[model samples]
Target chain A: MTTGEPGACVLGVDSGGSGLRAALVVPRELRRPDPVRSPEPVRTGPRGIDAAHFMAQLLPMARGLLEKAGGGHITAVAVGAAGLATLGDDLRAELPSALAKALGVRRTALAADAVTAYAGALGDRPGAVVAAGTGMIAIGTDLTAWHRADGWGHLLGDCGGGAWIGRAGLEAAMRAHDGRRGGSRALLARAEAVFGPPAGLPGQLYPRTDRPAVLASFAPDVAACAADDPVADGILRAAARHIAEAAAAVCPSTETSADTSADTCEVAFTGGLFRLGEPLLAPLREEVAAQLPHARPVPAAGDPLDGALHIAAEIAAGRLRLPLDSRMLSVHGEGVTS
Target chain B: MTTGEPGACVLGVDSGGSGLRAALVVPRELRRPDPVRSPEPVRTGPRGIDAAHFMAQLLPMARGLLEKAGGGHITAVAVGAAGLATLGDDLRAELPSALAKALGVRRTALAADAVTAYAGALGDRPGAVVAAGTGMIAIGTDLTAWHRADGWGHLLGDCGGGAWIGRAGLEAAMRAHDGRRGGSRALLARAEAVFGPPAGLPGQLYPRTDRPAVLASFAPDVAACAADDPVADGILRAAARHIAEAAAAVCPSTETSADTSADTCEVAFTGGLFRLGEPLLAPLREEVAAQLPHARPVPAAGDPLDGALHIAAEIAAGRLRLPLDSRMLSVHGEGVTS
Candidate 1:
């Protein structure tokens, strides 16, 4: 609860619509002289909700991690949450205070989950990151300024994300039902088994259901059927184009850049949809190359939690300068002056 | 409330997401020997809601119509309603009884709004009709069977409807906000004027708002700006393609037809989007023609109420044999035998 030893340990948390993940590690060890000597993080359960119920799950998880770590002084805690975008200005302003009250720590930081993904992908470097999971968004930073594309939720955007892919699959299935499109026999049978008869799809989707999650559940089926199913392949190709376009929107084109260092836009990919591997990445790489010739895909250095930990370390070292609004960053229940 | 006198008059109603339109006409006059002698319908207020609240508005409207029509004997009442597709089979089964109870009529017919549009456009002929208003759907028939495409609501489908156009415009506006896309200055200003700023749009749309209506409201702006705004033009082009694709999906291809009569597919377009006239129709016709070379656009003979009246007249004369299941048809709360 108190401000523990200065250079001791830090807690990093990543919370999303599905659940929460947290890790505890030594701040100094994260930047260890020898990469092999870096201490392994203590991982825990997935236990969180949207921003509304964030504290309810987060407080206990933080306390549990502190208790389990035993003896070490917890220096700071950094959290990246899925629902941060919905909080708006007032809630964002109060976030540090809320975290301070719950974790009982004087040093804390908060950011959107996308930020953590970006940090995990590129560290403090200037590059673009496309995160496509239940939702999709692209974030690019030239160190001095940041740009965002899409991630406008399932209704308006998230064109190439899991939900988008699933929606495409469902539409194709419906088309197949009407004999409008082929390659839906397997998809239709699978959908019927998972939900109900094709006639009941509208009832299952609209008004009452947790639409994003339900639609996202269909993404895997689309991927599975992509090999033999022309419809699924078409969806994947379209998704790749959308994702690439989103990335291109955020990442600077090589032709426009004056600085040679910033000329090559190193892009990174993350989230559940990427786990589909070659089916998605093969076309996605082609799309990125076609759309942004200078952009190159790089493997992510760590996950969002690791990014959270990295941010926590930077905050402790007084080296963190967020390319965000002052109001977007809070420390110990107060705004941080950049 | 009595079954009145048979073959006296018939009431036909069309209900949509925004409002309802009804007409009262004599069935015998609908089949007048001289086409010029057909009596014009008695029109009333546009009074209806989505399927959930349909009866609340519909019952009163029906009562008011009967009261206004006074001495005329109501032979039959036929209704075509929006959101009918979302209703499960059980609810559809119970609709006739509910309608009968409300109107105090034994002979009643019910169908989805698209069916009425199709009937109005094609007039019992074997052809396709695409209705693109607040929502979009294509209905096609080969005399023996029916085919439907899209109309999956604003969330999943309604691909080329007013809502779809509006959504595309809104997305373009948001993309402009993020500097991801161009040609949205006028669109953004217009949106801000109507919806009170771009940042607040997500809050206004998701969870709480009447999303379809709100999105559809933007279509007019998109149509208005299409000539000058690249973003608006892009939206219109995409909408045209989607609409054509949907129509093509339902309409039988020229190559597959063994019957020479079916080779030339006559297509009729209806709904508010078509009211945009040439901006929509020109591109839509081109796309439809390109995709469906055999299909030609036709001017609708009458509106959905006329179609409903046509069905009512057929029912009064005992000449109506629906291509639907017998259980779907009821006469005075009793199932009809084909």
Candidate 2:
């Protein structure tokens, strides 16, 4: 509690379908008004680490980060994992202790990646955050309640995510091959450049073990072709509309809201899809505005790593107030209510 | 070649994602006005049999059927298999000889399931056939040209198929769980009845080896709830529209066609989705009419097995005028030009 005293450090991990990243930082560094520039992570790799082996996969990454921070006293360790939503309440409750023990930290926090993303984007404020990477979900809080929409996964949902865009691109490529409308020649060329002949697509797609990543890899091509390709542009617009709908779905209805602040909900966007910049953000903002006229577009104050570190700092000071169902555990594996 | 010979027999096989069926019949019996009543198949099992192992799986079934037919001189063996479209021309060409050797037949024919479905539905007449089972595709022949649309697979296409409906139902279930709109209480209840709890859906869906089958199992519930459930009704209507679109996409345009038959293209619907009957068919007819006014809905004249037998008979009589690329082979493995 000495406000980032020497050797007082915290570890934050953001693990998703696309990649795993862990950052170690002093708590005081997160107090700035602007977004915290995340320290270079000690370990990073392509994601889709199985939920069953999440703790096992994460422990080493946390350990590596702690080691890199030079034998410091870890105040807290926080993990925001993509598949965390699938874990039941009991499993979620058990995770804090497991993470505490694995990281050799006095305190630990675990949450769905969307929760951390919301916190990272809006901090302690009440608003909505739409995170679209390999998958997509929208999480929002109206101070009293939390709402979530979509992020179901590639097969069932994740409609506006990077993987979804990539899939749409691939479908357009195939349609072009069949001389169907709604396909772009540029998109087909881009796909052929990456995966060779379009005929080889099934070989590359069907039998591959890491299908999410393979599909998501096509997203960049979709973004790159958005300037001139109608198919790619259409895919992007549809994705933006979906993301906007997701945000509107999670945000409290303005008509029924008793809170005066609810008239204008702050909405923030994050994730790899946004890296396409205005090609994504412009349509996203427009659609969000169209759907929720009172939606005020705000740049995400930070990324999930920053959110994790902020939670870690708050947990260390016993000041964390999360609307999410979260538990903290001490090094001795005893639950600590925040 | 013999006509109505005592020993003249043809084997017809219909292999789809759900099951495989084989029947042996004399060619003369198939020339009846009514559809041939296929004899009980000797082998049946779940589909998704690999292309590489297609012969391995089919041989036993064909042999069993041949034995059941009681030592008749096998004239031809024709197979309509799911996933056949994904196989290359060379592999498809090779299938004729492979089947001929395995069945001790003089002629063999191999086609995508939709092709046989079309042949079965209209009996070589100029028209389109929309097949929506575990997957969906439309194959149409104007007698001079062949057209195909959709049936890309569960991931990229198959928009109106059982898998698609099942996926939509699951999404609605998840939406209901998240307290979002567009979820039917009945749909959720039906889903929980089969899969236990909604919370376990992602676990059941993501890691499963037979995802398509699992997804398809939900289609019946969607059909059952169509009358009372808005979500179910919407799903069914959308499916019908997609199926209609696919049919229209594959049919020849009336304006440009030199043949007057193009002005009134006959459209036949087949597969498990149609088993829902009017709840599925009514909207399908409406959508087809909306998309292609000249489209005429026709009851299927026969099943895929009958279509295979028809082809076999034609091959034996040297009267088959198939628009498709087909090859015949004798037991000695020499390619016999059609």
Candidate 3:
């Protein structure tokens, strides 16, 4: 896994829903550098991801990281970005050349954040990674091709994600306020305390551009109330089922025969949603076990930045093998063939 | 409700999700005028409804309607607007004065579209009206006060509404595409036919300002597939149950005591969603029958435009009996008192 010339460095960046972060790594030395972080996330526009805004935040951080690594020869750059599959056309079209010119790098990889998450969690191994943060997506690979499920953004999908859980909790709260069936008084009190009167929630929410994040902010409150509230617990259980379903959908089948019941697969859960603790995890664990009985659940070895670094190092070493999707993952410059 | 002076009229406008509609009513003769409609919906902004945008569309339409009515004296104007309950501050403060100054009106009544739909369906009678178009809401009164359930917009509640049903159908389609549980092949085929590749639906839908309407537009497709698809049937059934729940929540109690189920509230259905016909209404009928056995279901008497006209005529007649909530239903100028 460690392949680079002595005194050589590579850049890794993760531009995601929450923020932008970059790290510099000397792959030959096998030491992971601390990521330089920015609270600001890259902007999106009519064409999807704004390339100029991404570069504005990234170039400076990439430069600072390189300098902090003691002026090493920067050999490669890899970026894992949110919205990269559907919204990364502009980034893919421009970023490789942009980085090559600005940072004097010869190798670069542009990847969907999900792909990087897969790399981070399982490190090029054949497996599925369910990354649940402000949004949720499940990604998998059988070594030759990639598979994905449920990352269709907040409006169309992203079921079982943080926003989904928060929105479900809020719906139950509003239902209670209206005296409808399937309501919870605990969730209602929590919603009122967190977002004011239930009547005002629509006004507070519908107009916002950043609605997913705003919705996700309440997921913790939902988790907090899950222990005592059947409604809250139900919401989490439904979310857990969705998560496991997504995992099972993307997990590679291991049956050597068509009719075989036995199989083997690697499954891992990663990201901010796992931080909700046992109220969410206990049910998630049960659902995953029930739905993906043949798959083994494992811990994520690293974050997306680490995945970015892994891809960069692998590209530098001529050993990257996680498949090259035009939209999901692409290699550029001298590293295009390997 | 015929009390306007001879050669005098009242203006009625409905600014809703789909369009802007206005009518000039001759209450003295009890004649219903043909409505003038603009396809453009009023714009909303940070401060809620754009008063200037609303006035720009309304003033000219009002003046023209008045002129077409033989240059009649416009005594009052009643506007039934979407978002009026929550986003009508600018409209409430500025609309009355603007209409008064421009038209020399003495009376005005402004109401939420739900209220107008109620007025249109039952004509200020003691009953419940369920308005279901792109959004759904249940409103009821026992001749004393107003109660509402589930008009929380596309992102929140709007349970059993067109958007909700459409969203559920699309979710199933996506599940099918992803090879997840609860997937429906019929819905997948319908979704692919209507929206093209399932993978690109998020790009097609998420960026639009008219997301709810866009989602609602697919409701018929779901309905079309319901007869042959259990998934679609399940979605419709769930939606019907939600509709009944909302109706029951808002329906006024007629129980003489706490233990009696002998309620006599009349319930009526109105709006675009009902046009889905038996696929939706068939189950909705069963659900209403099961949930509100004592409540009677009645056919809608008129549309929201008719409701607006009725409100205007009632205001001119000085006989509007619907309770005057400051937000839900408001009376201005000379008609402030019954």
Candidate 4:
């Protein structure tokens, strides 16, 4: 079952509101230096939900990945899901159990989607990390502990998350429709181009099932418009400020020594939002840096899937611990087949 | 009908989104320094709309006032409305001519609710004022010039307006209902208290006919909660700041003299909101004063209706002029009356 290897193997999956990602690994090495079996990325969803629904999508995704991998060597599975807070502990526990039932395997663990993303970016390090995915959330650790601020979904806050960008883009489009905005031909054209034949735009956005992806698709156009458009720039600046606030909120509440460079922490980027490169990230980085001058933006080594696998390995090796360090993650995925 | 006297008489009516108030006025020199006419306060339901409805209410009220006056002559009629804005010439042209028609008179004039209040307070002097009535708005003006900001209505801005207070209070109630905030008993009790033996509290609030009044009733409770309730204080403070912003927007633009009293151009308070006295007004007045030292707050001259009448006299005298000074609002009202 173990591929005749002495070390243990466990799988980790980060099921987000937008997509599901899977990572498989050997407990002794968590680093994903190779692309083979290290942390294979697979995009699946109809999004995640409160714990019960999270487990539902997750278990099937895990089983499919396990089936494809020839199953025998897996010791445990860990799932990271979005909306875990809303579900509270009751549903979280039930979800882990539900996953085991669905996969016909008894071993499983669960944590916040944010925690996993933090693990991916910081490798269990204490510094804070925000997952600006379809929804934005900030999670951090002061080495001894962790805290979160403003991840209350789209209706409440999310801030610099993908959904916000998408919503902003859509609003810009609507403003164009109503002739309130000065000009947005580029945005209009992009929307028209997306809803080919043009007539279906309303149905696609208002009623169609693919609204999230459809909206997410608009983020790029918004980024493109940001430099040339004042309105777009305003929106991006606001988003960046919001995310920076989130990061600041989660950071340790204390004053440190004068050597800020050493005292400052990394503000890692993970999720589709970071892909916009500097157009979006630069402002966000600037905002966070303005507040926490010592903090620097570090690109995620890979993504949350990698961190999930790294964490899974830690658990298998009996080295599972909180305040995971970046060094542990750096080496954890090296031996896994990418 | 002149009663063989050089003294003038003016009728001032204050109309809001929901009600109408008419005041019979005898200018300061003609009677006791206080200008209010006893009894017959001039009221009408939901008659804040057209000339016809207004006439229906006004004729009776006017007749009663005249009858009470032992057949004194009427010199001029001045009217001020809450919802009406001084929308420059273009928007003003679009306003229904029915307003003049409703008063059932050859002379009719209109002015901003804020201006009316300003005139009532400063009597054609140059200064600024922050009015938080059913909704919040701030307007300031030098005698011949004016500036305004943030009266974008309930959904857009309103800020410290009564409606804003009510909405914040409602939100607090909802938070308490959902267990997000504890001990909102005062808000709930106040809400229930206002609805009266209202076929029950919920019944009165939900009944289509009573919803507007029921909702309006919450604004006072919001202020009441501010003294001790954190949630209530948060709402009031935010609103106060919003109102302050509105006042600040006009401060630089206002006209004033170097030797004028320090509080001259500083923001002043009027409207029902100030009736809550210092608790609410102090913070609002301070915030605005902090921003614009000259942003003074003066007590209103009884009501905007007085200002309206004052303006009506000036208009009848052919003193109608452009860029009317808000201080001489009575003069402004008179100038526009014809």
True contacts kept of each: 0.39, 0.38, 0.71, 0.00
What clash count does candidate 1 reach? 1
Kindly give the stretch of ten consecutive residues in candidate 4 chain A with the minimal lDDT sum.
A325-334
Q: Candidate 1: what's its TM-score on chain B?
A: 0.80
* lDDT by residue (tens digit), candidate 3, A1-338: 45457767888889976688888886445668678887688888867788888888888887787677777767888899888878887887787788878778889899999998999999987879999988889988877778899998787778999999999989999999998998889999999998998899997898688999889999999999988899999999999999999999999887532223426788989999999999999999999889999899999999898999989888888788798888889999983763
lDDT of 2 at B213: 82
Q: Candidate 3's error at B161, in angstroms?
A: 1.0
Model 2 alpha-carbon miss at residue A218, Å: 3.0
The whole-model lDDT of each prediction reads 0.69, 0.71, 0.86, 0.56
CAPRI classification of candidate 3: medium
Candidate 3 C-alpha lDDT tens digits along B1-338: 45457767887889976679998876455667788987588998877888889889888888888777767778888899998878899988888888788888888899999999999999977878999988899999876788999999887899999999999999999999999899899999989999999988998998788888888888999999999999999999999999999999988888522224335888999998999989998999999999988789999999988898889888877888888898899988873752
Question: In lDDT terms, which candidate is top?
Answer: 3
> Tens digits of per-residue lDDT for model 1 on A1-338?
11235437777777665467777775334341211111222222222223435555566666666566564655677777665655534335554667666655556777778888888788877788898888899988776666788888887778889999998888777766655534377677777777787767876787555788889999888888888877788889989988988888888565554345665888999877899777788899889888888777899887787788777766765667556533233444334553
How well is each residue in A216-261 modelled by candidate 2, as lDDT tens digits? 8899899999988878988999988888878888886666544655
| Clash statistics: count for each candidate | 1, 0, 0, 44
Q: Write down the lDDT that model 1 would get.
A: 0.69
Task: Rank the models by lDDT, top first.
Answer: 3, 2, 1, 4
Model 3 stretches with alpha carbons more than 4 Å out:
A27-30, A43-56, A256-263, B27-31, B43-47, B50-56, B256-263, B335-338
Candidate 2, residues B198-291: lDDT per residue as tens digits? Answer: 7677778888888988898899889999899888999999998878777877776666544665558888887767897777888987898898
The digit string of per-residue lDDT tens for model 4 on A1-338 reads 12124544577776654466665664344354332221323322223245555454555555565565455456666566554443334444354455445544334545677777887888855576878866777777665555666554442345567767766666555445433323265665666676653223543454344444566777777888888877667677877887787777666533542223345676776777778767787787678778767566677765777777666656555455555322112112223221
Q: Which segments of model 2 are wrong by more than 4 Å?
A: A1-6, A17-20, A27-71, A87-104, A143-145, A176-200, A225-231, A252-264, A324-335, B1-6, B27-70, B88-103, B179-186, B229-231, B253-263, B326-335
Range of the 10 consecutive residues with the lowest summed lDDT in candidate 4 chain B: B326-335
Q: Which of 1 and 4 is ahead in DockQ?
A: 1
Ordered by DockQ, highest first, the candidates read 3, 2, 1, 4
Q: TM per model?
A: 0.82, 0.83, 0.94, 0.49
